[model samples]
Target: MASLPQALPEQRAVGPVTRPAPPPIARVRRRRRPSGEPPPLPRQLRASGKWWLGLSAAVLLACVAVVATDTIRYVDVADTRVLQAIAGIRSPGLTAVADAAGMLAAAAVLHVIWLTDLVLLAVFRRWRHLLVWLGVGLLVINVGAAMATTLQRPRPFEVQVLGDWSGFAMPSLPVTVLAALLVSTLYSLVPPGRMRTIGKWLVCGLLVVTAASRLYLAQDHPTGVLAGIVLGVATPLAAFRLLTPNAAHPVRYTRSRPAHLDVSGERGAAIVRALQDQLGLVATDVAPFGLAGSGGSTPLKITVKAAGPQDDGGSCVFGKLYAATHVRSDRWYKLGRTLLYGRLEDEKPFSTVRRLVQYEDYVLRVFCDGGLPVPQPLGIVEITPEREYLLVTEFIAGAQEAGEAEIDDAVIDQGLAVVRRMWEIGMAHRDIKPANLLVRNGTLYLIDSAFAEVRPSPWRQAVDLANMMLVLALRTDAERVYRRARRHFSDEEIAEAFAATRGLTIPSQLRRMLRQQGRGLQDEFLALLPFRLPPVRIQRWTWRRGGLTVVTLAAATLAGYVSVGLLRSPL
Candidate 1:
């Protein structure tokens, strides 16, 4: 029930006279309220908690009252016929399946799954989901066991037990434990799409089968099973609605699925299909490579490579889609960077995805021709009128991050070589983070050149070297990295580098990481290079351009009007 993302209105202007479109009114988010009041509790929890609390209390009271008054018989009316129907439908095959399901629903299985889930959630830092799981498990076990003993309800069968049955069976503990764990685990961890849907249906089928087995095996009455299911489902559902992560976040790991024969699973299926047609090859699978999102703009991934005719895509290619909205944001972000860094983010007219795509393609061509290790840009594909453009490039499979590899002199040489090669061609990669540099089969490869340019600005070049220094220092000792870098660069060059990157901005998390690792990469670089670079002109539309022209016109017009008024006064 989100209230945002209202659709654009369809109305149009009637008059011939037209006006320039208005700039978007900025929505100023107040970080703190003027009243300095704590945020109000959500109605979801307040109202639902009251209702659930009352219902749970009433149910408990009713259970106790029924036990005390010996009115449990009234609720057991359907137990006899339900048991009869279940027992009559039994067969060897059905019995075998029931036995397997009974084992699956056993308390031991639930315990193991719960432990595994906790380990996973802990790794993901999904603390809220873990809390929900722990709370629900505790309630179901203690409360269900207490009800069973207090009610003193008998097993449906009088014969010697075919399997281990615990205590009285007023509320089936097995059903309660299994269903609660399955539902909560699935709901909390599953992402949106077909995978989630299939998981839900599969869990539901298992629940139905397990519930029937309880009745057929004469382990509990239908009422007991029904009670277990109600408590199990209701508790987890209510808890998780209030507990799951409230925001999208980046995970520490990436998961790759085995490409299926069809591309239906992919969100960019239409774009994939078009690529398939263009290549004249059947695309058996698609792997989405969206930059794990929310905190930053994400790039889309389209690859039918896995399930292609070969082990890899028949063609050695991968695809990226830049959505229109992201393009608009890039324009503003590039402008901000230009102001702060005094470097051109992109050519004039603003940073559109189309413009970036073209720039990237041209840059990649330059690298390919110059014998640099970079991905070959294939072509560009347009997917929509809103500027959803796709860039195709050669795939470099199983590339390792620089941080993951050994940070010895050899690795340092590879990094230096890449930067020095770019410098030879008067090029600079403004962003030289650990993620952007990759190593494959002992060779370093550079990817994500969307922010690169052929500008040979001294400061910009120095930023690349300084950023690399910071990145490598995190992996190894500062002195070792510095000594290795000295072999490739002189003291003066190193000094200029640190000087050039005086105002570099890095991601907050990365900054904290460098701090925790016993050294400041940038500080160390600055300490080595005491001198700064001289002023150099960079292409940008400053106030000196548009603003200066407008100001001059206004001044001239004012002077002319004043002169005319003086002449009239004299007359």
Candidate 2:
């Protein structure tokens, strides 16, 4: 072997094998711009400026009028007769006239704004704007009344036989009108900016000037004028911001659900059969899961099946039946046909729950149209006047009710993302407890819209957000849980939500028991610490600005505070 190596086998020269270069990438062709098309305008700039201009002009006119009137008040030369006449006009008679004039003027302006809003809605099909306008009008009325009560500034000195005068003197009617007009006018004309700095400044300045002019004109005292402006200014701003842009508020319940009698001698079995037949539910084949709830309440059975005929006789789909006995004064067996065909909610008046379900049905449809992930509603059927209500829906298989501990950090992260999407769409769950939130095959699903209201009250929205926070807080750090919620909601909103659920009952007694144990827990925690920041520290940190996330988290914190207190307690 060594001798052969020494001979050095003629080294086979290896040539560098060359591969052909990849074919030149096909060039991406640039899309040609459409011929002669103008660039699109920014939405903010496209908003009409006419209202702003008109408001500016009106303010100038009012200023001029005030100055001219003041000059007249001081410069008039008066003999005894002239003085007497001037005094007569300035007396209660003239005061009454001026007051009436102010009211009439306010009414006229309000009517004009209303008509303009209606016309705009009709032409541009912007109902949201119309709602804003209506809300503004309501706020103005409230402010005006409050101003009159707060400021008792009196009229100019005058004497008249049988004269009549009333209302506060400081903020002159003209000045109040000017302030309201400017605010409302600007709101109507200006488009919403991400920050709205210019509009905010404009409103602030208008209020200041209106108050100053009224005092200078001697129509109202400085205090009265200031009070009126303050009142007026506060309302519109609070209402405008609180209303939430583009929120579609459903009609409030005007009347209670009517209590109708059960149909005479209706049998529970017969009604169930009739409904099954009508809805084409094959109740005979499937095994049903039965549950008995609070007494005088219904017994529910969940049954699964497929819709159409199957050769193999195996179906994966299911339906739920809610049946309850309807009791009369005589304690007769008039099987209550009242059945909840759909999901349930936290403790609520039955009537309210029904309304909520109806609203949710419509809202879910809306969400579907808008491309949001929501459970598809098949249909709802009422079985009887007093016995049962049934809802047919796509049963999410392998879905599990989220438990307190199971809904940990990961679940919360995913759930909050869904929450953000809901807020962006101007919607809230109105009920965010674990029961309503489902995890099916590892995907979080929002269910149980029986208490769902589209664009609910601020309190309601907060409660909904808090409910979710409570769910997360049960298994996670309170601080971190709230921080996550604030990424979508504000502190004030959170506080409000907590306030709403103050007296509400939880579905689980364990939760209630923990809450009961946690009374004065915040104080106890404070006492235990050597030093402590304010309880609202989390709120301040999260929602000091109007950030959506902050507001959302604020809600969550309140929920978390309550939830964690319950969870950590020695049960």
Candidate 3:
């Protein structure tokens, strides 16, 4: 009762401050997303090595200025103290060894190393690696020597010189040359792994020891050594960035038989030169495959002397060349597909030639790793920025169509088994036609893997089964193909397969062959094999749907505002 005077303020019903509660509407705000196109790459990403180069270059210039002006003369004392400290630990044996190691990384030895590396690279035909090696050498040795000579800074005075040397002190020619040579050589030659990591640490240790040796021998100042190290690391990396963009090969093909190619044309000649210059390939001859499709990529067959590492100096391989016109077409088609229609063809979203080639190369390797039969992917080559790209692969010759080969039960069984294997591997060959299936030396090889996809859904896998069965139908009876397929497919799966082919794109060549063999292939497949239609997904909300929703909400909001204005109007 005493607490009545101290009762809850909220429960005081007759309080003057009483207020009504807000209406509990179940609406949530929809935040407007930014425009679909991605923002530009960051400055660091766009410039890459150039940013590091600029920073290192600025530091180098500042060090040179400091040494020239003697603005911080006491800082130079640290340089002298570093030398004295290193010399204090120096023994005759360690000095001799360091001196010898220094001599090994000398200009003469470096030049010899460069020449020898180039010759061996020429032997293995590691042209890109050779280019990087040469570029590093020139950037480190020649340009560094010139910079040192121009700076013309003097060596430390009143310091005990353990070894003899003559040079400016701004950038230690020894440090710059040795660091760049070691880093660049390792970068180009060593594959990324534990070995590469070990190589980096070893190089780093050597560089530090070498820098310490220069200090101990009273060869250069600390600032000079620091400048040399920065220059050495940055210059070679910048050169490497410029030299290699697309790897050793950059082409991919969609079809085995192309209707048009000009290997002797201007673009073809440029392609040959690019391969020769970048990859060190001696092209004995180049021939066009006359690939079909107006802008689709095709492979050019090339006979080369030392085209690959395992070459006996001469071998034949397939090369796909993509010039400026074709690259743009690919870009436009992919952009349109993604932004407008939002569909991918054969699971490969359209991209540049270099990237697409890389994807296929990776896919081919995966298939090979899993023991699937496919052409061995050789390498990729980029001639111009986005204009010219080329991809090389092992050329399998003397292969004919399934239609040309004997259409026995074994052939049918093998073909169906392959489709099953593809499905087992979660792969789908979107372009499974008789022409793409080759019979070579009594073995079936699946070719034109450009449209191949992995990890397909059951619906997509069913579509592939239908396509494979259709291709086999070209050589023999549709019923015969159905019997072989039924072993792998259930009734529901088979029904879904038939239903999936409603609007599948068929090549004109395969379409003609199917019509010639019999009537409508779809009808024949349905009549020959018993099947039922499977449920399909209706497309959910798209950009259009969301856009319409937003528009309706905005329109209602506007109408309410107008009504409020009319209510407020003077009459």
Q: What are the per-residue Cα lDDT tens digits for candidate 2 across 1-571? A: 0111111223211122122221111112223325563212101212223344344345434434544566323322222233344444464555555444443224355455445655654465333444565555555554454444453334644423222234655344444544555555455445555335587686676556534333222344443454345544444444444342211111111231111212222333433354354445443333332121122222223242343454234333333333231122102111111111111121223333234334556776766554444556655445532334445454555666554335655567666655655655667665566555667545666665544556544544545555666666555545555555455544544454454443342345326534755643223322323333332211221222334345556866874574334223210
Error of 3 at 263 (Å): 2.5
Segments of candidate 2 deviating more than 4 angstroms: 1-276, 285-304, 307-360, 363-374, 385-387, 425-428, 490-501, 505-510, 513-571
lDDT leader: 3
TM-score, predicted candidate 3 vs. hidden true structure? 0.46
Which segments of model 1 are wrong by more than 4 Å? 1-267, 290-316, 341-352, 503-512, 516-518, 528-571
Per-residue CA lDDT of model 1 for 133-157, tens digit only, reads 7667666777887888888888775
Selected candidate, larger TM-score, 1 vs 2: 1
lDDT (Cα atoms) of all candidates against the true structure: 0.60, 0.43, 0.62
Q: TM-score per candidate, in order?
A: 0.46, 0.35, 0.46
- How far in Å is the alpha carbon of 30 misplaced in model 1? 53
Candidate 1 local Cα displacement, residue 563, angstroms: 41
| Model 3 spans > 4 angstroms off | 1-261, 276-281, 293-295, 305-315, 331-348, 516-518, 535-541, 544-571
RMSD of each: 23.5, 25.3, 27.6
